[model samples]
Target: MHTLDQLKQYEKEFIEKGYFVLDLNNMEYVKEASDLLQKHLQKITNNSEITLYNYHAFFEDNDKHYEMQFQMLQFFREQQFAQNIIQSNIDVYQFLLGPDLEIQTEPYLRITRPHKPKDNIGYHRDTFYGTGPGEISSVIPFINLSEKSTLSVVPKSHIIPDRFFKLNQVVNTEVPKDSKRHKMGFLYAPKVMDPEIRNDVIPIPLKRGQALVFMLSIIHGSEENNTDYPRWSTDIRVRNSLTSLNEAMKAGYYKPLKDSATTQTFERLSQ
Candidate 1:
């Protein structure tokens, strides 16, 4: 367990950069959790393409799926690993927003599997998807990853509040010749408001079970999973309690819940 002071240091890093990696100090828990999750995922998926994109849990038949398309957090909750995440969330919110801050976990799970050449997600901010007015997000690696498999991000994109990336600009881009997206779907390449700011881009590589937390407005994306092995990771967002979807529903930003997976509550995410 980390002292509040240590968590504050991590929060300072996040304040300076858009993201910070937790030392996670719980390798045994991660190994056990990862093994269990991988086995669980295998029982439901053997599809080459969907597996390549880390899109497995989208199917209703894949055990008890929750959130976006992945079901690992459900396992975390069932296995008591959720306690660790909750503690981190509490410490993090306190460190970043003071003790008065509250946090809420939304119902979206992003599991990314960079397989083959073209499955990388394109450069975009979470605001594009309308996730509410909170900055905290967690990315947990299910496997140990090398630099080639790390997520590459533009460090302060979230701080660039005046500029927003539009869906249209990204849609018209030609996939890079060196990118895996040419063969797969579309690659997630990092874009900057100014190409001259090369120092803004950083590649974050993580150990199995270690998670990186960042702001949602952060301009981030990933590179091709070029290794012979598959790279799998999961992302979940935490909204400030005051900006929660439950509050948004009362504010009339979102309709009552429906079965639509892609449906979003827009008011919390953007104006």
Candidate 2:
């Protein structure tokens, strides 16, 4: 846990650089989550030797891979893994997002297999998808990440004026027709189409037991995993409960993670 003074410095850095790295120190929860995932993968693949890094090798069909991804997502939600992670690092979240916070109901489980370009996400801001500016994005890697398999971000890009760049909604046509992503429509992310912007983007290498917290407005994405090992990570959004939220963001997409004493008292009195 960071001291109050250290957290203040991190807050300044996050405001200036659009992101900050936090040391979780609590790897027990991460290990438990990863173990749960591996067990699920083993059952799905019907191979006791299945591991997260090598699970991709078992799927010869893209449709099967998509189906597995959806199943994993459902399992995560059913197990409340996201909430468990948040609670494990409650102190850090309280420092970053305030005492009263709300977390994404279903955190994104990003699996970038080695040499898989189709799994790569494009550069964009969460604000483009109706997330409020007050929301913060957090990425926790289950395994060590190298530059080739880590997330890339343009430092300070969150503060850049919108007029400086144009956004185009890019869709992944490669998504299988029967996949849930396909049914969600072609609208994926509003990407910055200018190739010149790539010059400023840099991959952030992360070790296990660490997290990357960034402003939602930051222009960030990941490239194809070129490393020999697969990348497993979870990205979730959190914000102060007092902050303004859009209707879409509030539509069962977020759940309260922390409540202030005043809020607790009010709820009790109301009841």
How well does model 2 score by local distance difference test?
Answer: 0.78
- Candidate 2 residues 1-271, lDDT tens each? 6688878877898989999888775778787888898899888778898788887787646677667777887787788876787788888778877788988887777777788766666677766677785689889888889888899999999898766886665655565544575432223433545777778899999987788889988888875888977788888888888988887643777888889999999999999
Expressed as tens digits, the lDDT of each residue in 53-90 for candidate 1 is 24432443322222323345455445644334545445
Q: Residue 119 in model 2: shift from native, Å?
A: 0.6
On lDDT, the leading prediction is 2
Q: How close is candidate 1 to the true structure, as a TM-score?
A: 0.61
RMSD of 2: 2.4
Query: Which residue pairs in candidate 2 collide?
Result: none
Stretches off by above 4 angstroms in model 2 are 171-179, 182-189
Candidate RMSDs in order: 10.2, 2.4
Per model, state how many residue pairs clash.
7, 0
Candidate 1 stretches with Cα past 4 Å from truth are 42-84, 87-89, 98-118, 162-200, 244-271
